[model samples]
Target: MTLCLLTITTPSAVEDVIVDWFLEQEDIGDFNSMPAFGHGSHEGKMSVAERVTGRSRKTMFQLHLSLPTVERILAKLKKDFAGTEIHYMMSPLMRAGDLTAYEA
Candidate 1:
């Protein structure tokens, strides 16, 4: 088994919808840890600065998945979210050490 970091980025406005879909996925069982963070403009923030920003607001989610191969995970994700614009990054972990040590 390998430890991989899956970072998902979605539009701020559609964060809830995307999160709901992810939680309902059969393949994605209990995540080692799942946290949601909010990023957007402040009340007094300037619109020009926001306009220059590539993404106005984005929600990043991390998941730990054990798969036979990375290709399999990618295939499954593509099949599941056909039209949804989801971006992900996968990095192979060299050493996870022990889960018990990190468990809460």
Candidate 2:
């Protein structure tokens, strides 16, 4: 199987649409999310803390999926959130699951 890892990050405002997209996928069995924040710049606009600390709140969505499923998700994200500020990546998974019963 074409096992892999996919992750996406975006501002909190887009959480609803992002979540909806994930929910719509039937092939993707499971995924996860966590609170995260990072330094970013746009339109030359920045708060004092954002300038000095260079930090902003963000939500990260992660998916463990096969190549085909990942491709479909990418197409949806590209079409649904075109021109929006978002970040994503995919990586090959060597192994996953429990230490003794690891599946590769």
Candidate 3:
């Protein structure tokens, strides 16, 4: 099966809600997330402290999924997270697998 990588970055303040929303998606099997620092020139999106530091705290989630799945997920996110400062990007995944599953 073919797959794409969907990366979503959201404000740290809404991390919990974002995570919960992901967990509620029955089509999603698993995903990876971590604390991230976003450095951008969008002054309107940054807080005073972040502006001074030139970096904003964010939560990033990545999922390896089929193209159709990615589209569906993105549509849902748009509907549910409207008005929230959520950023996303998609990349074509050449391959994905666990090294441990390989034989020596």
- Number of the predicted model whose lDDT against the real structure is largest: 3
Candidate 3 residues lying further than 4 Å off, grouped into runs, are none
Residue 98, model 1: lDDT of: 54
Rank by lDDT, highest first: 3, 2, 1
Candidate 2 segments exceeding 4 Å error: 40-49, 98-104
Estimate, for each residue in 8-75, the C-alpha lDDT of model 1 and write its tens digit: 66555566766676677776654432344323443223256555662245566766666454456678
Error of 2 at 89 (Å): 1.0
**Model 2 CA lDDT for position 17:** 78
Q: Model 1, residue 20: displacement in angstroms?
A: 1.6
The lDDT values for all models are 0.59, 0.78, 0.90
Report model 1's TM-score to 2 decimal places. 0.58
Residue 60, candidate 2: alpha-carbon lDDT: 90
Worst 10 residues of 3 by lDDT: 39-48
Clashing residue pairs, backbone N/CA/C < 3 A, model 3? none
- Give the per-residue lDDT digits (tens) of candidate 2, residues 2-99: 77889888877778877887788787666788888767575144458767877776789888788888898889889989986678999998656657
List the lowest-lDDT window of 10 residues for candidate 1: 37-46
